[model samples]
Target chain A: MQKTASITIRRKFRVGNLVFHVLVIAFALFMIYPLLWMLTSSFKPGTEIFKSASFLPETWTLESYTYGWEGISGYSFGVFLGNSLFVVALVMVGNVFTCSLTAFAFAKIRFPLSSFWFAIMLGTLMLPFHARLIPQYIIYNDLGWVNTYIPLVLPKFFATEGFFVFMMTQYMRGLPREMDEASRIDGCGFFMHYWRIILPLTVPSIITTCIFSFIWTWNDFFSQMIYLSKIETYTVALALRQYVDAMGNSYWGALFAMSIVSLMPLLFIFIGFQRFLMDGVTMGSIKG
Target chain B: MNGKRREACAGYLFMTPWLLGLFGFTLIPMLISLYYSFTDFDLLTPETWIGISNYVKMFADKKFVGSLGVTFKFVFIGVPLQLAFALLLAVLFKKERRGIRLYRAAYYLPSLFGSSIAVAILWRRIFNKTGLVNQVLALLGIQGQNWIASPGTALNTLIVLQVWQFGASMVIFLASLKQIPTDYYEAATLDGAGKLRQFFSITLPLLTPMVFFNIVMQFINAFQSFTPAYIVSSGTGGPLNSTMFYSLYLYIKGFGEFQMGYASAMAWVLLLIIAAFTGLIFGTSKNWVHYD
Candidate 1:
């Protein structure tokens, strides 16, 4: 009787486990189906995009990719990709360097009103970017910085991205302060302590900042729309917008093709540095 | 030189770029926006003082009121549902030992590209009358509405999109769940506590802090959601203004209509509302959100 009861309990547990696995698999498939559908649709002819229910292309073709590469008006998709790359690369470099600098000051340095300034930085993080839009536009217009990558990448140089600064500060705070003291005893100054001791040790946080900055800047559309008006200066996000004119004909096939193309670099970065991204997000949450 | 003095100097030097950016970009624009909110400056005209007329007019403006209601509904409805779904999934996934990493990456892929133009457009396609969603409904022998184009379901479609990208919050929840000491569960099991009881008594309290954080962040994001609505609605927020998100309407007012002064007032009001909500969340967090 005892042996049969134990067997029954074990069988119940197995059933529960199977149910759990099946549920998760079903949800995962649901989560990924739209993306898979979009991918297959990109390879389908323009007329076939909406007609097919299956996520596989019945008639595989590369015509959409060619048409998308041709781009709208005179600007090819290459220009948009180049523009996005240039902007995202500069912004990523600026964020890693400048945010770390500010973070170092906040974490290790002894400054007057340092806590107050740090609070102010945190405050800026909560403020909606839309609140600053009109005035920032006017200022950029005055400076002739509108329609330029300057508006896009220049803020990174100043460490205006408070999230990165906060993340780096948390990372820096966790590091051993003895290294700084040890380096100082050896006649190293503030910059030397930073360059030799602090910066190298904060590699994880730095990489996190770089990966996030690249992805955010690459995917950002609103700011790009606000600042960039000319076709020549359009980023990938903005360039994608040009494919779908609200009042006119929309090149859905070309749009899907180009979108898939545009998302490739981000996917590559995400797949490669997913651990950093996950760590960054979770760390930022706990610390913040 | 004294160590304190030298350190102070170095600190100030290090913070120079950020301070300049704060004053130039954030602070100055804020002040200018405040000034613009009270004026009638529309890019072509000189600044004319209008006092609280813009604010007063905001209350009377049908579209503004409609957008505000829509946004409030979106935030309140979307945030909790998203967080709940994320937590549920996180709880389930925490125990799974095999292929978990691959599952996580797959789930996270949507959020990575959630706000992109491509995804937004794809969302529109999926919600169209002849789209995949309807096709699936047909398979199940149930008719599907034109989800994106219809007034009744447009905003809900947007809400579904918002909830679909809950992977980030799920990650946070999973992290928090992992932080919960296993000894609690072990002890509860020894006491013959069921899974539901343990979850409520142990997991719920411990996860509150992370839940609060996700709530605040997601609420803020929902309010600021522009790209998806913009792309999905083809920049018009049409089908009877069902998906007229606040930011989308604000964009239309400021950029499309060039109503800089009115938009500035609208922006300040949004800032105030968001600040109040954030403050309220933080204030109330003391009661429910256990930090330790």
Candidate 2:
């Protein structure tokens, strides 16, 4: 009797576990369904999108991708993609060099008013961008940098993006200050110590900053839209929007195709560095 | 010749970029916005000085009031609901079950692409008149309204979209949960505490810091929510202005209408509102937030 009851309990447990696994799998599918739909719709013929309910394209073609790249917008996406790449690359370099330098000082250097300045920096994090948008626009206009990428890329050189600064500072704080002291004892000046010793040791934090700045600059629409008015200067995001705005009825397939193409690079970068992204975000939030 | 003097100069030099940007981009603009609030400046021409008239106009403006109301509704309802969903999912995924990594990844994917224009466009498609949601309703023998086009349901649809990306907060909460001592729960179980009881007694208390963090973050983020509304409503605050969020209205005033001075005033007002709301949260946090 005991043996029979034990067998029944074990069977029930197995059934329960199976049910749990099935539910998890279904939830995963639901989360991924939109991306899948976007991918499939991108390949489908324009008419097939509205006609078919299947997740897979009945007749796949590269027409949409090619058309999306060159046809819909008078300006080819190559220009926009290049512009975006230039801006992102500049911002990445600026963020790594400047944000890390500032973060190093805040973390290792002992100075009067250091804590006070740190508090002030954290306080600035609460300042909403909208509050400063009008003023920024006027300044950029006065500088005649409105149509250029200067306004977008220049801010990073100043360590104005507070989130990156704060993340780098926290990571630096976790490291031993003995490294700085030892470097100093070795007759290295602050700049040399920063350049040779601190920079190399903080590769993880530097990568974190680079990844964030790249993704942010890549996906940034509002500032880019506000700054770059001419079609020649437009990023892929602005170009994509124009396509939708112009050909409202027949271009949904092309728009989806371009979106898939635009998002792939960012998606790849994110997944490739998922660990750093997760750690960076977790560290930033925990300290707050 | 003094070390102190050299160090001070070095510190200033290190902070030069930030100071320049802060003064040029942040501080000067902030001050300029304050000045512009009292003027009627268009970008094409010089400023025309006006007094409290802009503030008065804002108070009397029906659209402004409507947008504020819409924003308020979003903040009050959306923030709590999003945080709750995030916490629930965090707890569910916190256990050491098999295949939990897949669940974690699935839950986090939405937030990974949360603010992307592509996701926003997808949201519009999902809630369209004859979209996937309506198709599902049809399967249930129920008729679905034109969710994005109808005035009654448009803003609510955006709210639902905002709530859907609760993954960021969930990940943070999961991290915080891991920090809680397992011994506390083990000791509680020794006293014959049930799972639910132990959760309230131990988990909730330990998780308060993260709860406060998520609340403040969500509130701030929701207040600045512009992309989803812009994309979903097709940039018109739509169908009957049901989806005109505060930030969207500000954008319309500044960029669409070219009322730079008035928009600056509106921007300052928004900053004040956000500051006041966050201040209130911090003030009340003393009572409930527990730290180890």
Candidate with best lDDT: 1
Candidate 2, residue A245: lDDT: 81
Query: lDDT of each model, Cα atoms only?
Result: 0.87, 0.82
Tens-place lDDT digits, model 2, residues A49-159: 756567788999978888888844477877878888899999999888778877877877766787887887877788878888887898889989989999898888888
Model 2 scores a C-alpha lDDT of 0.82
Question: Cα RMSD (Å) between model 1 and the true structure?
Answer: 2.3
**For this target, which candidate reaches the highest DockQ against the unseen true structure?**
1
Instruction: Give one digit per residue, the lDDT tens place, for model 1 in B63-108.
Output: 9999998899888998898888889988887865777887777777
i-RMS for every candidate (Å) is 1.2, 1.8
TM-score of candidate 1 relative to the true fold: 0.96
| TM-score on alpha carbons, each prediction | 0.96, 0.94
| CAPRI quality level assigned to candidate 2 from its DockQ score | medium
Query: For candidate 2, lDDT tens digit of each residue in B195-221?
Result: 899989999988898888788878987
Model 2 clash pairs are: none
Kindly list the per-residue Cα lDDT of model 1 for residues A1-288, writing each as its tens digit. 979988998798887877867887898999899888878888999888777677788899999899999976788999999999999999998898888999999999989999999999989988999888899888888888998988888888999999889888888888887887898889999999999899999998888888888888988999999999999998999888888772133457788899899999889998888887654353544445
